[model samples]
Target: MDQTTLLLFIAATFVVAGFVKGVIGLGLPTIAVGILGVVMAPAQAAALLVIPNLVTNSWQLSGPKLKAIALRLWPMLAGTCLGTWAGAGLLEKAKDGSATLWLGVALVLYALVGLKAAKLRVPAAHEAWLGPVVGVLTGVSTAATGVFVLPAVPYLQALGFEKEELVQALGLSFIVSTVALAFGLIGAGALDWTIAGASLLALLPALAGMGVGQAIRQRISAATFKLCFFAGLLALGCYLVLRAMG
Candidate 1:
């Protein structure tokens, strides 16, 4: 892509990604990577996501709930950091179309469960053991695919969090995942100043789109937004799967 085209693409991609995140409280990385991956290399795409992901999620993390949520999530957060470090090695060694395939599979599974509106409950007793396990999986997936929702989102859902709490938890989880992924990318030499600068620039458009999405959220039902979200995920998943196969 030329300079003009690349600028346009970045503007458009973040607008869409941020809108989704504004509405659903997550999906920035998934949407950004899914769209940008079509036109660029995976490592570069992942690198571009680092700054925006961290910045947005940090905003989402600020609230009275922050401390409570952090206490609740410390174990998972720790596991995620470790897993991302390990998974970075996997990313470095990835061959064929494994990264795309993994991303495709993760999207499809996430969409299916979301579309079904499945309500899974984890007994409190299970959370200590399960949360870390899920975090590790989410970290590995994020490192390899630049998509961080997988087991993390589902596990959060299973906790039966109130809607607001769920949103906060998602923010916290994503913040940790983004930081971990950035470190992983830096270690792998996938993140550099140029991509980081571009990523920082993308933040404005993303924040602007979030403003628009937040307005729309007031007018539309959450159920409607969720339906659209899952539908989009399904289509994106199919595209990724086919692209990998082709």
Candidate 2:
């Protein structure tokens, strides 16, 4: 794609991704990375997501129980950082479209889990050991595919946090994931000034889209939107997988 077209594509993709995030409390990086993966390497797409993901997720961190959530989730957060560091350069080094293939697989699995509406419950006793395990898996996936939703989201949901607290927990986890992924990308020499600037510029439209989504959130059926979101993700994931294989 030419420069102008690429720029337009990036902008439009972020708008839609941001809107999804606003309504659902997550998916900016997943949607942006998956769509951008069609035209660019996963590492490059991940670089473009750093700023937007960080800023948007940071916005979601405002809540009364922030400290409590942080305290409760520290093990997982630390594990994510360590796992991401260990997995650094995987995407950059992937050969034969492997990164794209894995990205597609990640999306497909995530979509299926969401579509299934699994109501897993994590007993408090097991959280101490299980959280870090899930975090490590999530971090490794993020390092390879530029997506971090897998077991992390599911695990967080299983914790049975109330609605607002769950949102805050997701925000905190995403913030850590974004920062960890950014560092990983930087270590791999994938992120630089140009990508950072473009990512920063993408933030405006993202925020705008978020505003529109938030405005409509009260009026729309979240369950219906979620159904469509997962369905789209499933289709997109299959397409990416086939494209990679072909």
Top candidate (lDDT): 2
For residues 36-155, what per-residue lDDT tens digits would candidate 1 score against the true structure? 878876667788888788888876666677788889888888889888888895555565777887788888898999999988999999879887898888888888888888888888
Q: What do the candidate models score in CA lDDT, each in turn?
A: 0.84, 0.92
lDDT measured at residue 93 in model 2 versus the true structure, 0 to 100:
94
lDDT of 1 at 75: 87
Q: Roughly what TM-score does model 2 have, to 2 decimal places?
A: 0.98
Residue 108 local lDDT, model 1: 89
Clash list (residue pairs), candidate 1: none
- Give each model a TM-score: 0.95, 0.98
Backbone-clash count (model 1): 0
lDDT value, candidate 2, whole model: 0.92
Pull out the clashing pairs in model 2.
none
lDDT of 1 at 235: 94
List CA RMSD, all candidates. Answer: 1.4, 0.9
